[model samples]
Target: MDVFEHIQSAKGPSLFLLPEWQNRCHLLTAGFTGRSGGVSESPYTSLNMGLHVGDMDETVIKNRQLVSDALDWPFEAWTCAEQVHGNRVQRVTEEERGSGRETLANVIKGCDAIITNVPNVLLVSYYADCVPLYFYDPVHHAIALAHAGWKGTVQQIAQETILAMAEAYGSRPQELVAAIGPSIGICCYEVDGPVIGQVTLLLEKLGCSDDSADTMLELSDNGRANLNLKEINRQIMIKAGILPIHIELTQWCTGCRRDLFYSHRMEGGSTGRMASWIGIRER
Candidate 1:
């Protein structure tokens, strides 16, 4: 079964929702945004959620409003960070709610992952082809969002986010329900040089068997390789103590579904970004 369900209306933004998590907890809303039904122009086309991507501030804000409206969430609760593709995890509190919603003035800086137990704060991270990792510590009412590119992945951002949650909210890894959101898949993501080297080191550190390592990273004779980031992150999650059964991995690849998602790799570097958001409303 596809863990993320695609929902679209003729007059609304296209969204991929995590229905299982929402049904498991009515107050929770978790999903990824798509590239249609908004107001940005050309390359961006419409529904560009990233302000840092050269889209007009007003246009991106309007697009964001459309998403929040569709989700029935107040735009005021939309909190985000300035992602540096590092493994730093910021602990969001009520005080940080709404940071970087409209402008970059107060965006949580220097962090690629944000975790919080603060209800009503919608934690969001932007992505085009890079992976979006979600962590829900149901037992502690804490949630986290991480942006993992090859750099962050090799740095073990998933494990870092899990440890951050445990330290901040006493979240047990076994009780953490996680989701790996849409991004480029191995079929569409090819890398070489330092990327392959870094990933090779990471697989070695993860203690992957030869067959498993080859599956996560298929090396070609030409010194290039196809990387399965989603699977690598899932293995990192399990290595960090999260149970395999509790994680939901999505099959949606932004690189392959250009009509539904904006792919930086496929789009010649100028593209919009989608958002991965997870929030729990106040009870």
Candidate 2:
């Protein structure tokens, strides 16, 4: 039942209770991957959507086209950043589609998150270790997508994007339904002392509490702390005043499901990326 909606012969990573996504005919979003689909050989394997990952351009293009077709979107309406991993959040419009090509040429000036009230403009971001966050305020019919690595998370990109939507589109935080996409979870995210300290400090500044959340933490073999990024972002969303019930964290971990996802740490630099995208449709 979790088969790829695009090809009769395709399958995706083991899905985990994405029924909210599957049931909503108008719900514009999806994510999670492993080694099953795509046309790239060996390293890239089957469903690699990244154009810059040394996969054949046409192959990547085809995978993209397949995704677009699966979602009933035009292939050309997709947007992505060069991903500088900064705190900048770009407000995507009708004009920014296809701006990422190379490390520069079609890339957005500098940004880590993207938002739009525009319909059918799917936003894509690559990830192997960082977290993917999605925002949708159906009341305003708008959506925002973000990538938060350690640096961007400390800068509170999720909170920033929510505020941006509030300012530009009058989207209320309570009306926003957020989804924490599949990412490196506590089981595989081992980090050193400084990052732990920084994350802790930021969590405090954001007013997150262990009391309100039933989250778990672990220490890796190297003594680095393993974190549940989905939970971390969920707490940030709560602090931003978003309704708790409206948030969904995909109960899947990329590193654990390496057969279904593209992990940078797992596949080295030669692997491709699985893209997470969300968008509104023109009413």
Candidate 3:
């Protein structure tokens, strides 16, 4: 069964929810947004969660508010980072809550991963086709949102987030539940040149066998390879000590489902973004 359940409500933002996680902890909410039920115009055409995109700032903020309304989360708690496709993980605290909600100023800087144990602080990251990595430590009541493109994946952002959580919140990797959200799958993610070289080096560093590497990167005759970033990140999570069974990998490919998602590759680089969010409320 798919870990993220798609839900479209008549009066709210479209969302892909992590129902099992929500059910396991009534105070927790975790999910990704879809490209519908917002107020942005064409290209963005409704729900565009990214303020940095060409979408009007007001429209993007309204769309974000719609999501906050749907999630029943306070808009003041929507914290985000300016993702730089790097492995740096920022630890969000109570004072940093609500940064980057309405504007880019005061946003957490140059980090792909943001984690927080502070209750009611929602950590969000934007994506069109890049992978969204989620980490939750129920024992510590902490959660994280990481944006990983192929660059961040090669930098081992997953492992970096795990280590940051351990150092900041005393979260054990084995005890943490993680999720790899929707992104371009191998079916539609083809790459050549340095991307292929970097992925090959990463796989080797992960000690993946030839068969494992083959599964992650299928080389074509034209010097391009189809890359499965979700799988690669899953393996990285396992290597970083997260239990394989505890990690949920979604099969929804943004490239394949452009009707429901924004595909940067398929959409010719002019597209809006979806958001992946995770938070816990104080009881």
Candidate 4:
């Protein structure tokens, strides 16, 4: 749960590497550079991997290569979506690899979530403010990655991934270990009237008491309220049958920690993206 600071290098922007991922199997780690880690001059900083963003294509390519070299994993190992913000889940295979800088139209079908049973095929989804959910099933030898924005959260994208694993790879929710990666936490994720109402409806449908959900959230001095996105997603996981003990959450908020991660809410669309990826190497 420690936040690692960025270490500048003359060659390129280096990410604060995680010790857990060096040789660990069935492990998840991503506390890398924020918008500032890389060779990009301004706006995109140095490590922006988002192709759709307005950053120069060559700069994005250089940044992606930097991230791949820093992690010591092949750039082709990661797969991402155009991210339509839906409930669809796509299965990843060895054939889908090799996109050092693949165009969006080439790889992005109609999927928001990705799962893989093949070793070394990492499933990745980009984020500036949206929550990324990572899952691993040691028993079934499977993995799933999901992007859960408010709409996707309400649709329970995490639950859908678990269900997909069960159907495709015989993975059970109870056996699946999950981690809700860094994103815009409730402390910084303010919503308008309709958005709150949407969340309220989902919360109620999930059997959360109306009184409790409403009461637990209170306005700050300036009238801003903190809503725990991790907690709510955790509730969805449990209701879908995952045990509480198998879940992990980070208190890091993308908006709050702008120096370590990107935040769309914090930087009004002129921002780079932070990516979370997970893969199981072959035995």
Question: Local distance difference test, per candidate?
Answer: 0.96, 0.72, 0.94, 0.73
- TM-score between model 1 and native: 0.99
For candidate 4, write residues 73-126 as lDDT tens digits.
687776677688888988776777643245676665777788888877656678
lDDT of 1 at 245: 100
Q: Which residue pairs show collisions in model 1? A: none
State model 3's lDDT.
0.94
User: How far does residue 1 in candidate 3 sit from its true spot (Å)?
Assistant: 4.3
Candidate 3 worst ten-residue window by lDDT: 5-14
- Give model 2's clash tally: 10
lDDT of predicted model 1: 0.96
Instruction: Give one digit per residue, the lDDT tens place, for model 2 in 1-283.
Output: 3322222333533222345654663555555434455567767887776776788877777776666666677777778887777777788888887666333468676788988888777787777768888888778788888998878888888999999999989999988888887777777777788887787777678666665332434445675777667788888898898999888876666788777677886566667787777765666
Runs off by more than 4 Å, candidate 3: none
For each candidate, give its TM-score against the true structure: 0.99, 0.86, 0.99, 0.87
**Which of candidates 1 and 4 is the stronger one according to TM-score?**
1
